[model samples]
Target chain A: MRQTILSISNLSKTFGGVVATDDLSLDVEQGELHAIIGPNGAGKTTLIAQLSGEIFPDNGRILFQNKNITMLPPFKRSHLGIARSFQITSLMQGMDVIDNVALATQANDGHAYKFWKPARDDRDLRQSAIDALKEVGLEGREFEKVQNLSHGEHRQLEIAMALATQPHLLLLDEPMAGMGTEEGDKILKILQKLKKRKTILLIEHDMDVVFALADRITVLVYGRAIASGSPQSIKTDERVREAYLGTEGDLNC
Target chain B: MRNLLTRKSFNFAFIISVGLLALLPLYVEMTGDDFYLDLANRLMILAIAAVSLNLILGHGGMISFGHAAYLGIGAYSVGIPAYYEIYDGLFQIITAVFVSGVFALLTGAVSLRTKGVYFIMITMAFTQMAFFGIVSIEEYGGDDGLVIDTRSTFGNFFDLEDTVTLYYFVFVSLLISLFIVKRIMESRFGMVISGSKSNERRMQSIGYNTYRYKLVCYVLSGCLCGYAGALLGNFTNFISPEMMDWTASGELIFMVLLGGSGALLGPLWGAASFVLLEEWLSSITTYWHFFFGALLILVVLFARGGIDGLLSKIGLSK
Candidate 1:
């Protein structure tokens, strides 16, 4: 039996008069790649933010591994093995590429009080960071400054940092948002390998990548999960067609 | 852009400069020309203050404009006790650090909640409050300042009454302060502080409670600045409300920027360059502030990372 790794119950959040997430309930099975698809302003990023504890929902209960994580701070959420990547490529700029990932790894270790030994001199820490970079195809670019990287490389570094955290569940917001076909494929392959071990809640706009990687799909419209099921069910659901997938009709992007 | 002032490339400059400083008092002892010793002492004391500010301003991305308040607090720890004929060196040092630490914890709890310019404004306001509070105490000479007739006494083994002893005291304090900051900057705690400075939001997502780290950094900085103030009190034989004015805080910041804010040895370099510039510019013209302002703009525009960056760019550091 596949246990639910994460369960969100009746999540509702509004920014002033505008509703961002409204009465939404969702669940992700263990070791499954779940993709969230929605139009622009459909509260995709907003949901990701709530899941990552960047913002609290007006009302909701977030359960990770059956533990109630509602009202927890972002760092607390991170401590409970929930890692996240920002869609806007939030990274530690001016730091070296490997140093960015190493910080994330150090964050996972959660022992930041030691104030004498040099962090860079820790070979174990450096090796793990290097491993994360190589997993995302970013090896040999360790010493490059983050600002010096290209946009696509920034996206890869974002994933590398997330990977460095060594989380049980990964919350990714538009991992392939600004990439050429080749770079997108690179991330797709990484996600395929990652799903075998970690549960992923992915927010992506690229339909082709969505169909290629997701074990299941949830279609969101105006902050509500209008339809959700296996890829075949979502593609054929009539309400999903009218609310979000109307023009796209086919599952093959 | 090339890597600017990475720790790997800084050994050449820092080692050479510190070595020169370490050997300086010997030259002074032999020559009896105590002028350079006095100047070096002043810059080194100020350099310690600058370094403390850099802990928050550079690594933690906190721009505190009220740092000189701790300077006053430390000096008063010496001055106020001495006013009653209580001049225990250990008691003065303990009182200075304790008071500044408490002040930092209280003020930082409020100021760290603000960001950017608001943070800067709030810190300056707190320092001004300290300045005004000291000014109102009529018993301590108030606006006129208090002069210390006797220096701090450490039993019998180490007496600060000797001029050379006091100079060496300041010198050792400067070296110790630099060493502590340098070690902290490379440690795990430093990684989090530096990372938070880069992107605080991302740091939270990565499991760091950035506020606590920054607050701790702020307190550490304030306490160290207070210690520097204690030394200044002993060296100058004077303590006044004027020492903690907001402009004094501004000058400390100026030293940090001129040296290289994030670079480990930047503040020391900054204090040296600032003192030399002030001496040289005033010698040439009375309109030194105007010339200094123009020079600040030039350094900020072209040298982004300050003197250390310039040296690294010229391949002189590596």
Candidate 2:
């Protein structure tokens, strides 16, 4: 009898003649790692965008902690404890690694209208950023500029920023998209550790990671959810196999 | 590769420049050339205006082409009162800041909704509107401009009419403005503004209401520039509609770009070089503008970071 943390009811969005999110409905329970998988052009990014308030659904409602948040802007949703990591690693590239994480922590703490004290001198904020970076295994690279970080490190930093916000639910969009096997393993370990503490909605393209990490799996096909079940059931489900898993090659791994 | 010089060296250069400016009046007096005092005053006033512009343009990534409108509003705030013989320095400065702040709030509310080229064009249009409005006011000398009978008075504490007193006053004000702007840039509020400039969509995703922060920055920049306008009106003892012309706004942008947009002392360096070039070139030829324009083009082409950037290149990599 797990409690539902996020409930998307009949969400629909379209771009011109293309239906990007076609009457999609799904529920994620507290502390459960729910993964969304689909082929290219299956509107996986579009679904994440709607949940994070980047794009609005033409019809339907989104509920977080039993409160409707369909129309709330991204910042409001973030304040309500929904944090997201981007698929493309959207960070302040010119800033230092610690400062980037500190900004995320600062956003929810209080009003940022205080114009006198330097943020760099705020020990609490800096410590919080350091702790988040430590969690992501980026301890000694605090002052390094984000532009100089490796692709794997950027992905790790992305997750660190999301975690620094102290979110109740994490919406991770391809957290290991463009990484080598070593980098991917590092993120997997981090995600595995995070799974014990937070409710995670993961969007991943790698079948092995999805099968290993996801408690429940939802397969999307052309903006519609075609199957929803436990990873064991989804692996065996004939419709999911034909719609997506088949084209992704053998799901045996 | 390691940098040739560190940030410490850049800072040393900044301190030396400020020190030179502080002792400029003594140098002018010793050289028996009182005209340098006037040039120094003009440079400091414009430097204040350029620093204000840098807050929005350099830090916030807002391109306002109508920033000169605030300057005009500030000057008229002083001129209109002086027309009635008020001649109070505090009142003139207060009104100038207030008027410019309100105008920025209103215009920024609308202009901030648009981005890129639209923001520039809308700001330009707003400045032109302010220019025309001032031009049609016959009581304040209309397009012909107005002259103050007496400089603003600060009671027995200070006299604006005394050239030496005025020089010290402007010099102190410039330093204060620089300190305030630099402090704001280092604050938590500054992080959000700079973050927005870097990636606005990412900022929103991270839970920042960027619009509100940007508007506040806009108003604050306008207020500072308006103060500079008030000082300029006192310096020249005249206020005119031409002060807020679009070309004047362009010159301010050039100053920011020429010095270094985001650097603290870049605008000051830009203002000094621009004014000195104008004076030196105009003495040689009447068509000095052509040469100035060429210099600006060269700066834009070769010196992407302006003078401050060039200085940084010689020292730190940043």
Candidate 3:
């Protein structure tokens, strides 16, 4: 039996009168690549926000390694090994690619109050960043400024940044969103490799990638989980088809 | 723009500026131009204060409009003690650093919680408060200010009596301030502060408590500016509520931006330009400030990195 690495129960959040997350509960086992998919306004990103501690849920309990982390701040959650990539492509636009990843690596290293020695000269930090960049196929472009990188490169950098944290669970909010087929395929390959070693809770809109990558799939509609199971089970669920998946003819597989 | 200024022209501009400052005393001694030496002394002190401002304002991306309050606090550290015959330079320097550091810690704690225009307003309000607080104090001479009968004395270390001695003292302080700012920016602490300025959310999500880093930087900046104030008090031989005025703080900000806010040597250039322009323009006309204001507007309109930006682009092209 696989151990549950992350557990969320009765998670709920609201903005004014609109229910962004309505009594949502989910769980992912160790090393499982769980995918959450839905149409627009399905609260997928909102759910990721709560999990990453960007915003607190109205009511819920989040257990990471059996520790309650629901009220923890974002940085504290990061320290606990929960890393996230934003849907809007958030990064330090001023810094270069390697330094960006190096900063993320430095974050998890230890206290940063060392106000004398140069951080850029630390061999261990730079090496770890290089390793993460190489993993994301961004090795040769380490010196490139983030502002000059293409959108696809930005996504790759985003993944590299998440990986540099050495996180146990990566909450990737649409890693392949707005990418061309070539870029999307690169991300798919990276995710395929990552799934073997890390537990990733991904939110993606591409059904083919979802069905192709996720070990387990959860269908969300209007902030509620309508269906969650293996790929074949979710593909046939009547409620999921009516609410989100649509006709089986569109599955294309 | 990365280091608050481009690195391209840094070598060219910084070396030239420092060389000139280093040779100024010898030139003055040979030419017997004591007036110019005095002017350079005042210029360097303000430069030290501006450099301290640049640390938080430029690299750390914290806009503090109330930095001059620390200047007043530092000056008063000397003025008040000297009034009662406490002339130990060690006590004065420590008081300047400790008192201003504490003040920054308290005010920065409140100021840093805000952002954008509100941050500017709240900081200005604090300076106004400090200004009025001193104005209302009768024992410190209120608006009339205080005159120090005897300058601060160090125990056989160095005396601040002679203008030449004071000039060297101020010069060394300026260099030290620049060195400190440079070291801090390259340090691990500097990286976090710069990262926080770039994308604070990213910094937090990456597991850094950015608030604490920024607070420490703010306090350090305040302490350095306070030391500059102590030197200012000694130079003018006076202390007054006028030292902490919001306008004085605004001038400091102007110097930072005019020189190039983030570049290591930007403040030095800014303070030099301000002093020279003020002196030259006033000598030419009674309304010389009109021309100075116009010149500043022109620089703002034309220069991207202020003086640093223009020079870097030139350096880039060549």
**Which candidate gets the maximum DockQ versus the true structure?**
1
Order by TM-score, highest first = 2, 3, 1
* Model 1 spans with C-alpha error above 4 angstroms: A251-253, B1-12, B29-31
lDDT of 3 by residue, B3-54 (tens): 4223443376677767887888889889997898889988999999999999
Which residue pairs show backbone clashes in model 3? B4-B262
Error of 1 at B206 (Å): 0.6
Question: After superposing candidate 2, which stretches have Cα over 4 Å from the reference?
Answer: A245-249, B1-10, B316-318
Error of 3 at B313 (Å): 2.2
Question: Among these predicted structures, which one has the highest lDDT?
Answer: 2
TM-score of each predicted structure versus truth: 0.95, 0.97, 0.96
Judged by TM-score, which candidate is best?
2
Q: Score candidate 1 by TM-score against the native.
A: 0.95
Fnat of every candidate, listed in order = 0.85, 0.78, 0.76
Model 3 lDDT tens row, A35-121: 999889999999998998889999989999899999999999899999999888999988888889989999999858888887777
- What are the candidates' C-alpha RMSDs? 2.5, 2.5, 2.7
Task: Please give me the DockQ of candidate 1 compared with the native complex.
Answer: 0.64
- DockQ, all candidates in order: 0.64, 0.60, 0.59
**For model 1 chain A, the run of ten residues with the poorest summed lDDT:** A244-253
| lDDT (tens digit, per residue) of candidate 2 on A80-193 | 999999999899978889889999999989758879898888879989999999999999898899999999999999999999999999999999999999999999999999
